[model samples]
Target: MKWTPQDIETYLNAKEYVDTAVVPLLAVSVGGEMKQSAAGAEFITLLSGHLERQFTGRLLLLPPFTYLKSNYGENTIRDLREWEANLAKEECKHIFYLTSELDWRTQEGGLIGTVIWLPSIPLEHMNDSQKMAVVDSQVKQLLELFTQKWHENQ
Candidate 1:
């Protein structure tokens, strides 16, 4: 399910079965590196969409949790924790934060939910078929990780 009115309606009807939330962590920059930041967000968004499709009934795809690249620090982690708390209160058993920013990897230990950091794959030059092929391959690997996490918690 996605974070849309229609999807939320379906999700409410099957809330218990959809115990997971997938959030894409996006870092925005308005400097010279802005293009790189946008590319990372694009790649992550595509990957998250593909991932959600693979587990539509089991996961809720939330909007990107965006933060300024220059403001990524203790405050950012604290805000992300608040998101986790709210989701947990709503009975979400699993929360996954997917990102292409390497900074997230260093802060994973301080976070309660899983933080998956993948190096950004430049997709601007890829054709539709090529893009699908790359996203599919990444999602396949992610599927294993998700299932493993589910089993561990069970």
Candidate 2:
């Protein structure tokens, strides 16, 4: 389910069947790399929305977890772990963090959730059809990975 009031209500009613939580990890920056950060955010947000639609009732797609690009390290891990802990208490068996920031890969060991890193694709230049095609392709690839993870855990 997407993070909307109506979806939350639906989730609350059928929370038992939704065992997974998907979070988009976004990096914000106002410095020289501002454009890149924004691009990543846009890509991940669109991709995540598409992903959530694919499995609306099976997982909850939380809002993007934003952190400054300049501030990443132990603090980031700590904050994300806090989120994981809370989700676990809510009965989320699988927590997936999706991002376009490659730096997060290094900190995966400290996280209980799975971290998926995909390079950012500039969507600003693409037309609606093009953007949909690109996002669709990425979701297709991710569908296999998500299913594999679910099966392994089961």
Candidate 3:
């Protein structure tokens, strides 16, 4: 389910079946490279929306967690873990953090959830059809991950 008032109501009632929450971790550059960060955010938004649609009945797609790349570090780890922990209170068994930021993968932090990092695609330069093609391939990977998680639970 996408994050919405109506969806939240359904989720509250059917939390038993909805066992996963998907969050997009986004970082914006505050120094001098705004264009690259904008492209990254667009890629993440498209990919995340597609993921939510594919798993609509099972997962909740939360808003993007935006932070300045210039200010990322130990505190970033804290914020991510804390966010995951708080989401656990919603009774979600799995939390998936999706992103195209390659830098986040190298950061050392406790894992409260699984992080799926895809290479950043330049969506702004691509035509809609081309963008959809990229999204399609990525969706397959995401579905496989979700399937693996579900089977493990059983």
**TM-score for all models, in order of appearance:** 0.98, 0.98, 0.92
Evaluate residue 99 in candidate 3 and report its C-alpha lDDT on the 0 to 100 scale. 81
Instruction: Supply every candidate's count of residue pairs whose N, Cα or C atoms clash at under 3 angstroms.
Output: 0, 0, 0
lDDT of 3 at 31: 48
Q: lDDT of model 2 at residue 134?
A: 100
**lDDT tens digits by residue: candidate 2, 28-122:** 99979999999999999999999999998999999999999889878988898999999999989999999999899998887888999999999
Candidate 3, residue 25: lDDT? 88
Q: Report lDDT (Cα) of residue 80, candidate 1.
A: 94
Query: What RMSD value applies to candidate 2?
Result: 0.7
Across 29-84, the per-residue lDDT of candidate 1 in tens digits comes to 99898999999999999999999999999999999999999999999999999999
Regions of candidate 3 where Cα sits further than 4 Å from its true position:
107-109
* Residue 46 displacement (Å), model 1: 0.2
> Residue 121: error of model 1 in Å?
0.3
